[model samples]
Every structure is written in C-alpha cells, then in structure tokens.
Target: MEMKNNTVEVNHIRKAYGNRAVVNDLSFVVKPGEIFGLIGPNGAGKTTTIRMMMDIIKPDSGEVKILGETLTEGAKNNIGYLPEERGLYKKLSVIDSIIYFASLKGVDAKTAGKRAEELLKRVDMIGHRQKKIEELSRGMGQIIQVIVTIIHSPQLIILDEPTASLDPVNAQLLKEIMLDLRKQGKTVIMSTHRMNEIEEMCDRILMINKGRLVLYGDIPSIKAKYRNNSVLIEFQGELGEIPGVTEKRPHDHAVELMLDNKTTPQMVLETLVHKRINVNRFELSTPSLNEIFIKVAGDERE
Candidate 1:
C-alpha cells in the first residue's frame, strides 16, 4: 500500500527523558484497517512511543505521521484514543459524558447522542446510559470509556490496556467491536497485557524492550520465528522422565513439554510407549505468544 493509505508511520522515532532513552530509533508501519498490537514488559517504552504518536509528548528526533500528516489539532479528530488511565465525568450521565466528548471531536450533539445510545446498547450498557458515571462499576465504566473514544467515529482508534477492567464476557464484546471497526475499514492500535488478545485480534505486532525493537512482524511470522520443537501430551501417571524433554509443565489434566533440538514428537511417543506409559493424545506445536513475549521481554523461565 502507498504511504498515504497507511494509518500510521513511525520513522526512526526517538524519545528521551534526561540521559536515558525512552524510545530508541523505533520504526514501524500500521496499515489501514488492521489491528496492530504494541506490547512489551513493564518499563518497555511502549507508553512513550504511543505518547509520541498521539502528540501528547514529542519525540527528540525522527517523525510520526498519522493518516499521512503530522499529528495536529485537525488531525487529532481523525484519531480516537482510549488511554490506559481511564477517566470519565463522575457526576455526568454516561450518555451525556460520551456525547460531550463526541462534540469535542466535532460531532454534533444530536448525532453524538444517537451514536452513544446505539453503542451503549451494543455493549449492554444502554440501561445505565442515563445514570451517573460514578454509579457504574469499574468494568461497566470502562465500557463507557471505549464508547467515548469512538463516539465521533474516528478513522483510527488507539486503545491502551483496554481490557484491563473488563471481565471475560465484556472483554469478548470489546473484541467484537475491534473486529467491527476493522470491517468498517478503520485501523486499530491496541496495547494489551493479555497475549491471547494479541493472538486473537491483532494482524501485526511490534514488540519492544528497553526502548529497542525486539520483534516486529505479522503474528504468524513472529510465532514461526520463535517456534519451539515441542509437544503437548495428555497422559496418565508418571512418564518416568522422558528423554529429550528440556522442560515439563504439569497442568490440571495434561502436561506440556519443551523438546530439545533434534527431538521429535514421534521419538517422545516411542519412548513413552516403550516405558509402558498410557498416552491419550499428543500434538506438536510452536511456542505461544506468551512464551515469545516472555523470551523477548527477558523474563523467560529456567
């Protein structure tokens, strides 16, 4: 796609606080109509990078182009941002608060109200629309925060730790909204601690650590790069310490193994069978996004 058609472009962006670099020579592209994930461990500079993109903070060097233009007040209306630190007018009614925010994005009050009603209903928050934001629970309030972000129907939406306050059910609803936005040809940048969210929702991901890019690619390609020679086994009783197993984890009903190099699932099964161990099922697979995240973030296990 042409540069003009892209949702965001970061060209060698760099940011610093004092003598320490917060973001170091970071560069990436977010295509139109795709969910792009930005993730890293604590203090990974993910927030700093996002701040630069939003123009909430400026980069020390390089540039960020949003919707083919430098981030400006006019350009700001085209991008919706849901901050990790959620806030809402406590005394204002939920619907009213969202409508007010929508107006700030240049949406008319009437249209904003209508959109708020529809969105609230979709999130199962319609009944509470007229209630004060302080009246809602943390999770319900978070749902409103999402509605507030997109009330004006921005072309690109940035969500930071959006599901932090949601339960599984509400989180699933948020995922549906994300897919719906993509279906409508809008781009989404999501920062989440939930690796499952990235795997299920993101098309591409950029992972950083200590202000440096550690991984940048589509989800499938990154997973393939970090693929492990491993197998999942559902068996009964002790397997008597199978050979070629570098790591073994016993869950409630099964075990997952990390196999060493040159080790194959077939060889593992043969050894199990030879030892007279009962094997119910087994399958070889690549490492999960969580595993890759741990490794990339320098938090891997022994």
Candidate 2:
C-alpha cells in the first residue's frame, strides 16, 4: 500500500488501440532489491504495459511511478531498459556500440570505456569486441545488448526476454549476472514466458492474460495455494486403485496418483509397501509454475 519505498509502483494502468484494450486496469509494485517477474501468454499485453512504464507510450488511464516519482528526463538516467526488440549500430564495433549507448545515458567516455571492457570480459565476449555488430551471431549480439544495458550501473534494470537469443551457457551466465546485480541492491524487472526462469529467479510474479491480471503473488505463496495433491511413483507392480488415491494417471515409466484430502503421501507409500510393490521412486508432486501458467491462461480461452 505504501509507495515511497518501492522501486516501481504501477497503479490501475490501462492502454488500448482504437477499439481493443490491450492492457486493462493493471496494477502492481516492485520492491527495492527484488527481482520481479512480469509474465503472460503471447498477445497478453505485456509489451504494451512495459512500453507505458517506460513512458515510450502513454496509457489511456492510470499512473506509473519509477523510484517513487513519475518518470522524468533526469530520472531516465538511473534506469536500464532492454525492450523485446533488439537494435544496435551495425557499422560500429562492439565496443563502440556499448560506449555509444552509455553516452546516451550520460556516462562519460572514460568511465564508459572502462566499464565496457569489464562487461565484455564478464560475458566472455571480449574477443568479439572489435567485430562490427552485423558480423556477430545472435547470441553474441544479445550479450552485447546486456552489457550496454547495465554499463551505466543504473539503480533499476528492466529486461524483456533478455535470454531469448542466448544458448544455454550464455543464458546461465546472464542469470549469474542478474543475481549479482540483485546482491548489489539493484532492483530488476524481468518479463519472460520461461516459467522455469520465473520460478528460479523471481521473488514475486504478476501474470496477465488478455490484458487482465490473472495471478499475482510471491512464488512460495502461489505454489502453496495450489498445494501438492498428487504423488508420483515409479514401481514394477500392477497399480490397482490404491485406497487413498482417487485417480491414477499412467505414464510409460511412472504413474501419478491423485490423492484425496484425507490421505497423505506417507499413507500411500505404506500401502504400496504392504502390497509388496517394488517402488523405485515416490514423492509428493507440487504443481510447477508452467502448469499453473497454462491453467490460468488456458482457462481464459475457455
């Protein structure tokens, strides 16, 4: 409820094009030193919302506050933003492009140049520093973009699908960089459809569907709300209806037993042991963020 201490406070923002409302009455807050996730299905108005937050586009109604104040020309310098769309000066060398972007954010050439070398090395792209942007691969370009985004050492960082062009190794490196930024007390906002990344990196998440808020909360609380009501087991015996399980979903190598509230996973394991079933693996199954995403967004379609 209090907005002053928050890094970002978005209140009742709405945006529409002609007849269709792309973002409708969306509101959320990002706390200082936390990684907040903004997620939704494609065409769910995430980009529209980010654009409004950056003041690249105006919302039909509502307010967006960055670092507790409305975005100003001077305030822009303290924030690092990477939009979904990627762009760079094709003719310029990698180091040149990084310095150019930093200069735009008011970082002097001396400091920017020093920071550029450090960041390029950090991302393992120092060897490509002299290459023109047009000559680099997609993953290489993404690394450069990331370096450019944070070269100025902004207080707040906003990235939309920052790992979209990266390989697994590069993506992992970026994750480390982001985690390091958080440790430095910089606030981060990441917008992506990668549910695994959301669960692993974000402290809180806001999910929108068809331009409307569907789910919003901390990761633990949200998963606890959809608490594990099933158990997965790998066994060799014929799985006749167990006493506590209501339904059995079969797999080629395993079976998931849906449990009633009255039965615990311990009870099911005991039942299997008593029946002489050779249990290789058994554990309570919690709903993954990806499953929850599909459920919430899929329900919107039906």
Candidate 3:
C-alpha cells in the first residue's frame, strides 16, 4: 500500500468552452487526510476544475495526478464525487436510489445496500428508507445524496456545495461527518461559497475568481497576510473619544476601529486610560475569512 501523502495534484490546468476560458491556468494540491477548500464565486470555474480532476471532462491543458498516478478507471472508482447540481431518481425508493449510485461507483450491490442503510440511519432518515425519492423533503433528499456520495468509503471525497438545500440539523450532521472522514485519514475536497464552513472545516484553501487562482494557503497564514490594521474593542457605557482612530463601526456596545498608519494599538489603550474610559475588552484580531474572501472574490460592489 502506498503511504498517505499528497492525494491530488493539478498542475497548470486550463479548460475552455468555445472561446471562453472556464479554468485558466489553475493549479493546486490536496494533501491526504485534510479538508482542502476550493472556493470561488458563481461562474468562477470551480465546477469546471472539479470535472477536470474527476476526468469527467478533460482539461484543455495540463495534468491531474491522483495518488501519484494518472487518473484511470481504478482512480475514479476510489473517488466519491457529489456535484453541485445533482438529483436522485424520483420514482426509486431512497435505499434503492442510494444503492444504485453507490453501485455505479463500483461498490458491490450487497455492500452498497448495507452501507446505504447505515448512512441513512446515521442522518436520521432510516424511517424513510422505503419512501420514494420524490416523497422525501428536499432536505431529506439532499442528505440522501450525501449518503450515496460516501457509501463506498472512498479515499477521496469531493463535495460541491454539499450543504446546499439542507436544514441546520442535517447541515451540522454533514459537517461532523466531514470532520470524521478527515479523522479516518480520508482526504476531502470541498467546494463552496460558504465562508463559515470553510473556516470551520478546511485545513487549507484555494480561492479562485474569473477562472484564475486568487489566494491559496493554510487559513491562518492567509488571514495573517490579509490582516486589516484594526482593533475590536468592547467597553461599557460609551466609547467617549479616542485619537489615532481613522474610522469606527459600532455594534452593541462594541466597536471596530480602523487605525491610522502611524497609530499603534498601545497608543489607543493609553488614550483610553488617559480619558478615563471604562474598558471591558481590548483585542487585536486578524481579518475574518469572510472579509478576505470578499476582497479577493468581489462583493458585487462593481
């Protein structure tokens, strides 16, 4: 058996439709046993890149290596892929539908059926195993889709917006399952626009926009690189007044202060003390993934 290390590698990949490029010169790697986040805005070439990786669509240029080898039928069978735009057979019962999809992934029918039932139970959908797909709620069907995606227990699972159309309870369950998969030494490639999920689950991330790589690295390092020169303060009564603060946004007795180029956090504290301001909390923190994501991916401000 090959020792676990780099699970996926995409080198200078590019894909196009007619004259329009979808994924332009994109490149990234997914390490084993980690949730690697692939995030971008709508029409940002996320799906295009994923398809190339799966060999569902060939990249116009570049190569994708899985488990240190070229993609093949064996590679595809060992990978679980849940597309963003997905559907289950409406006329088929839940268990049968799950079993069918898992079988397509090369799992034996008996094993697929058994694993499907267990997964449905885990997601609190065991009672509806016999129900037709159309009979279940949208959230329930989405859960089933996820179950099918992982029923084969593949080494690499790629989820494209897996939490879409799911309720909070099921969403939390899916998040827990993703984390558990990581713990079991399974590599997951998650593509989503949700910053909270990325922050909570991904060990590293690659952010792309307009079919080009924008940001790539571990979350903490990216946060540090994009740290806004600001302080988040929580104090009682009133903020009163403080110097060196270029701008401020207040919220529920707390304020986010944007400091001037020459203003230090220490100066702000000293000023507060000299002014006799009641201080409850003083902290300087890195910018959130949401903020940085918007900065790189655009917030539709243009």
Best by lDDT: 2
lDDT of 3 by residue, 1-302 (tens): 47565899999999989999999998888998899999988999999999999999999999999888879987788898899999999999998898888888888899988888788778878899999999988988888888888898999999998897788998999999999899999999999988999999999999998899989999999998998788888876667667889889886767989999899889998988887778888888688899898887665335
Order of candidate numbers by lDDT, starting with the best: 2, 1, 3
Superposed model 1: Cα runs more than 4 Å off: 1-4, 230-282, 299-302
TM-score of each: 0.84, 0.90, 0.89
How badly does each model clash, as a count of residue pairs? 0, 0, 0
Can you write out model 1's per-residue Cα lDDT over 1-302, one digit (the tens) per residue?
34357889999999988999989999999999899999988788988888899999999999999988899998999889999877998999997899889888999999998888889888877899889999999888888898998888999999988898899988988899999999998899999888999999999999998888889999888988888778888987777777899998876677888888888889998898899888898877778899899886765223
Q: Candidate 3's C-alpha lDDT?
A: 0.88
Model 2 per-residue lDDT tens digits across residues 1-302: 23349999999999989999999999999999999999999999999999898999999999999998999988889999999997899999998999999999999999999999998888778899899999998888888888888999999999999988789998999999999999999999999989999999999999999999998989989987876689999988777768978998986788889899999998999999999999999977778999889988888999
Q: Candidate 2 regions off by >4 Å?
A: 1-4, 234-244, 261-280
- Colliding residue pairs in candidate 2: none
Inter-residue clash pairs, candidate 3: none
Q: With candidate 1 superimposed using the best TM-score fit, by how many Å does residue 191's alpha carbon deviate from the native?
A: 0.3
- Candidate 2's TM-score reads 0.90
